[model samples]
Target: MHEQESTRLGDEIVRLVRMGARFRGMFKTGDLGAEFSALMLLPPLRAMGPMRVTDLAEFKQADPSTVSRQAAQLVKAGLARREADPADGRASRLAVTEAGVQACERVREARAAMLERALADWPAERITAFTDLFEEFNHAVEALLRTDPTTPPREPA
Candidate 1:
């Protein structure tokens, strides 16, 4: 890409990220009583099954203490539970509860509804093409971060 085109794309990406954060804040304050940070832990636990806090921290690229605190909130909210780790009887792992699964479903529905409303006027073909390209872009970014040793680690959005 030309320097000008690259700069424009980068600016657009940043704007998109800011808009997403604003949307998340609105959702967090509207119907999802849980803190966004704590809610974020659910997807990983759901996807990976039970995992130790340390493992989750590594997977999220966050500090273990932050993950532990989030896990505590989730536990207190009855969204997640602690279970004995079969691999290490002395340690415990966190697992998402049925309620947590339901919460995840609700979040997914809300996000979809928001997107549908926002794009209601867009042509179906355009929406489909955008979705495909967006997924590809995200995958490219993840691959770059994974393979590039010189890339600096940054906090998750």
Candidate 2:
């Protein structure tokens, strides 16, 4: 891509990202502060199944103390619980509770509602095309990570 085109792409992505962040903050009305931590589950929990608090901190780019406390709050709220990792006696792992699963499902519903509202008139093929392009873009990003593992990951769009 030409320099100007690359700049425009980045600018557009940044605008979308800022919009997404604001929307999340504004529309998370159903969630108590406790339920807000539910958003933190998808990445770490999805990839590693049950992960240690230290691992969750690294995966979520959060401080260990904060993750530890939040994990405790999740436990108290019955959203997630800690387990003894039998393979590693010293490490504790976290898994989402049934209530946490329900919360995740609620998040999915909200996401679907947002998409439906945004694309009320969008053609089905356009949605498919968007999915394809996004997957290709995701592949390119994974390639970049493989090429430069030390490069910090960009903020999501």
Candidate 3:
């Protein structure tokens, strides 16, 4: 094996290890038990605009009924709502409400606080670079998956 290839793989391993540790620390802070389905739903809803329940199921790689149930819970909690879809009269799209947006912001702020505490000793430049690189990686992976779902470039050998 090439020495350079070995070093690159080692760097990626280190990054993954650090990321897992940071996520563990964040979860430890919110005694919200082991279930954080609400938190998980928040980011995806924030990223994707209003979508039909079926669409949400597809995006989440989940069953339609599960997605519908979760989305219904979100609506009942006032975090999300069902709106008539203009394109399809018989269907509805689930969208986060104003209150939902506020809730999302709060959750994000708390997570950011956790991250800040974890990386307090790191230089600002290093943190910024890490964020940039992570987003770039996310984009690359998203593109790869969209192009071919059968195989992603980052899968383990």
Best by lDDT: 1
Candidate 3 per-residue lDDT over residues 56-141, each given as its tens digit? 77676666776777777778778788889999988889888877777677667777887888799999999999999889977876
Report lDDT (Cα) of residue 90, candidate 2.
Answer: 83
Please give, for residues 35-140, the per-residue lDDT of candidate 2 as tens digits: 4554566445744688888778776656677777778877877778889988898878998877777766677677778878889899999999998998998789
Of candidates 3 and 1, the better by lDDT: 1
Lowest-sum lDDT 10-residue window in model 1: 25-34
How far in Å is the alpha carbon of 38 misplaced in model 1?
1.6
> How high a TM-score does candidate 3 get?
0.68
Residue 134 of model 3, lDDT score:
83
Clash counts per candidate, in order, are 0, 0, 0
Query: Stretches of candidate 3 above 4 Å error?
Result: 1-35, 43-49, 58-65, 152-157
Q: Lowest summed-lDDT stretch of 10 residues in model 2?
A: 28-37
